[model samples]
Target chain A: MSENMGNKVSLELYRTQLLARYFEQRASDLFLENLVKGTNHLALGQEAVAAGFGVAMNKSDYTYCTYRGHTHTLVRGAPVAPMLGELMGRECGILGGKGGSMHLTSVEHGAMGSYAIIGAQLCIALGSAWSAQYLGTDQVTTVFFGDGTTNIGTFHEALNMAAVWKLPVVFVCENNLYMEYTPIGKVTAVEHPGADRASAYGLDSIIVDGNDADAVYHAAQDAYARARAGDGPSLIECKTYRHQGHSRADPGKYRPKEEVEAWFARDPISMYRLRMMENGFTDEDLTEMETEIQNTIDEATEVAKLSPVPSLDIIDKDVWADGGSAWRN
Target chain B: MAQLTYREAVAEGIAQEMRRDNNVVFLGEDIAAAGGVFKATVGLFEEFGEKRVIDTPISENAILGAAMGAAMTGLKPIAEIMFSDFLAVCWDMVVNEIAKARYMTNGQVKVPLVIRTANGGGSRFGAQHSQSVENWAMAVPGIKVVAPSNPSDVKGLLAAAIRDPDPVLFFEHKSLYAMKGEVPNGEHVLELGKASVLRQGDDATIVALAAMVPRAVKAAEILATKGIEVTVVDVRSLVPLDTQTILAETVKTGRLFTVEENPRLCGWGSEISSIVTEECFYDLDAPVIRITTPHVPLPSSDNLEDATIPTVERIVETILKNMG
Candidate 1:
């Protein structure tokens, strides 16, 4: 396949990537200013990967993601209002005010769910894919994880099952180089975490520029096509970085300023905007898009703040069978 | 009606389900060509082929997780975790994901998955492999826990588990695999959450589960020979425990002795004792007695393991002491 053929990200995809960055930045600001509680793992630099994967899939396809999942949720068309409302702990949240930021789901749009547990979504995603194939549905399940998650045993186990059973799943490894505070090299001896490992299980694996939205999108598209066509599962490792700390609290004192700035130079949102302009987006059009995103963010925040907190009865709810009756019983 | 061993009954139940529904599949470490480590899935691969009976990698988490996924997608998947002890490896999938998916999704999703594993300590397997870990499953919500002590119960309960809309953990005692009993020649589906009275009497009640049911029966016979009547109740399902039957028996007999193979502290026996004490305290002639394994790791030695577990000798003595 040619490098650019069927690999070029469309203008609409570019807007989504830009909006992901803008909304996450706004979320980070609101969080740091004490306007938001709980934790927030901003998908700042990794917007391209989420946008790319979302662009290559239909709404009917399934997606399961990790805690740092704001971009993935948005790209899957989770209304920004519910996303902000979730961060604000409101009744209007996506999970009906049950699951907070990390735990989000929109079953109608085929967003199977996103989990907070590290490497937990891997098995769940594989399960969903098995369900799709068992039910004879064309939908494929894509699970996104960080480079740190590759070190987990569940990741290896999940991949092996997907390969052995030939389940319809696309293992998206967004290698952000850090599993929390520690770097990937300190943990594992192997350099290419995803590239060589998938071969051990006879999986068709590939490495792509995680920052380049189009590359991730095209890789996902090929993998999805294979999965939908019953060619088994594939692992797509996208080398990327996290622009913010692992969580809302960490100031990222572990990283050097020069390294942080070097990564900032490759910010996915800016690159996508530049590409959009080069592809004939006027300055006025870019300005309008930016303003439109800002307005949406503003409206979302306002609406979320007024939304009611989950009812007091919900605290003991959804934890068990029969509406969590067993909890108190 | 043809007689069948507990193992054959379970295997037949799975086969019948697979034949009825194309979406029903079996996945485990050696369930496919190897016919399962215990041969519970023997001849299934020949009948259903690879797509249905799949031998997965040595990953308990993957096996259950894949089953959960398949169940979520509308497939009725029966995943075999070789031993109840190994269920720990996949607890996150079982307890967190499969058990909680229905309620978490606000009833939008249902994980119609069955995780079958062998429990109990009669095989003299070491502590790791011999534990009767039914309490852990009972503690979790949105998941039904069933322990079938006989061949007929195995066939009936397994079919019910497959047909149920929620996730079910089917615990078949490893020692009872070869035990033979009469079963209906045709399909038999037992209702879950209902306990069956194995032997009827009026003097006292013996509530037991899985392997302990047979032990309780022998204890009842000994008590009868001593001029004491004893009722033996097999508390099959643990999660939606048959509290009504237990209460009724306890109220009628005015005496109760619960038996289980697990550790004494907070064991299933302890739960039964508590329930009987709380709901039928006035009806009780004496405090509920519990005959359970000692609060220690299962010893590997034959003599030590025998001493640790609750036997008919111990159950008879406990019932006599409680009745007196």
Candidate 2:
């Protein structure tokens, strides 16, 4: 935990972490019931990284992340009902059911977008940073990706360009150790997938205990400050673990039992909960917070279940700014 | 009116928009100090300065991704993909990100940007550097595809594309870069989705785009000597196609022949042929013929390259053979 963080900030982090954890839990349950259609990549064990960055970021700063971005979107203050409704493909969803779980976006809240293509957002995020610099705004752009993305060409291209231009941006890698079904270490030449490559781009190699919210919050603060101060980009690698399989379909049978157990023991939400109790927080207070999260999740689930599927009229709508997909005038 | 080369028109078009709106900016590989490899954007860096007219590393993904992000936020960026063939290098950024951002986000984001690339194969730069990939852009939804034939259309159409609220892929034909033509003076902006009828005749209507327009026009001239007068229609924009004009011209002549620089399969002409067949089937005096490059990679050799793409002689021969 960082010494600079106040008790109030710590409690808020705990609440947001719980909110993400509970929302995903409900989402997992809904997926089994066939309520949430298609595939979903939940940030089950990576709540701290999202929560920390979410709290640390300004409302004006832009955020671009990968498909594992439900937690990030929620942390940006998107209402739970609409987000859940989006997963359910309902008309009242955040994107009006146009974009599914993997592509969650809220431009109004500065949550730019969640790209499914690996390493693409890193390049896209640079544009927002460039725009800020060109328009003379102090707003910083942050992009988050998985450890697997380090091997992709766009990652290298984006980093090189971002470094050359000294764009106001931060690249955060949530190194959960697995690249879909393959272990990242087997394919990667470097030890630290993201951090080790930082020096190559004229950036500091930063690695943080991703399970620690305070640590991530402080790291995020430093990166954001540097970006806002026009000191160029920073690449941070958060060493974390995902509790669930890559997606809902996988059972994660390939992993060794002992490795899974070790990661499970360091679950971010539980660790944060215990730390809160040690710092003058009661079990009752934590339990009350959990109950509040449960109620919010319950209400959001009900609203999502009741929401109607998108109308057929909107199928061709939004293909252009004219609200029609007509190719011929 | 000032006579400008197609390459000069490109710089003028970008300069016009950049001067008019502060939000409009230009970036690409060698586009700044080097004035673009094609020399199309010369003097832009001196006029616009470094902040607005910027040079980027040879990273297609970064160049386009940055353009997309800028467009989504506020700026109307004009990004050059040196060669149209290079679009394949950053296909995902162009198709997945830039094209679909607006639709996927339910209009929360608008990518008001132009990806200007030197398209087509008259330079014999081999298959890698030369390709008329406007059809590739046309196949994708939510992207406006424009390929200007003349210097005048280049300036006007490019201005329209930059001002458009959606993403536009502007294809400036490599062969037409040095071709000079009179450009309308001052703030010229032509409406997209409108085809230009460069010539009028009653026997047959020839539809062409970009480099093929000049060939088709020359073919019409040569065929005129043989008493087979033909109307030439330049299909300027592909996505928001001017179907009404195409149908009107085809219906008037009662015969249609499409001349395309793209390969035979799924070329822009195929779409026009399908449209003409569906709407003006009864009005046709003869089968709608399509004159296009054979389905093969453009060869680097001059003779092979010239034979592959539709030439004036080939267009005239095809028209003469099909006009019966």
**Which ten contiguous residues of candidate 1 chain B have the minimum total lDDT?**
B101-110
lDDT per residue (tens digit) for residues A1-329 in model 1: 12353324566577788779877987888787776688888888999999999989988888989888888988888888888877777887777666667776777777777777678789888888877777788989999998888878889999888887677899999988887898887887688788768888898669999999888888988999899899999998999888888897787889888988988998877887787677666778778878888888889888887888878777666544345545212
lDDT of 2 at B24: 97
- Cα lDDT tens digits, model 1, B15-85, are 87888888888888888898877777788999999878888888988888788877776788999999999
The alpha-carbon deviation from the true structure for residue B261 of candidate 2, after best TM-score superposition, in angstroms, is 1.0
TM-score, chain B, model 2, is 0.99
How does model 2 score by TM-score?
Answer: 0.99
| DockQ of candidate 1 compared with the true complex | 0.44
Q: Which lDDT tens digits does candidate 2 get at residues A144-262?
A: 99999999999999999999989999999999999998889999999999999999998999999999999999999999989888889999999998888999888778788999999
Report, for every candidate in turn, its global Cα lDDT versus the true structure: 0.84, 0.93
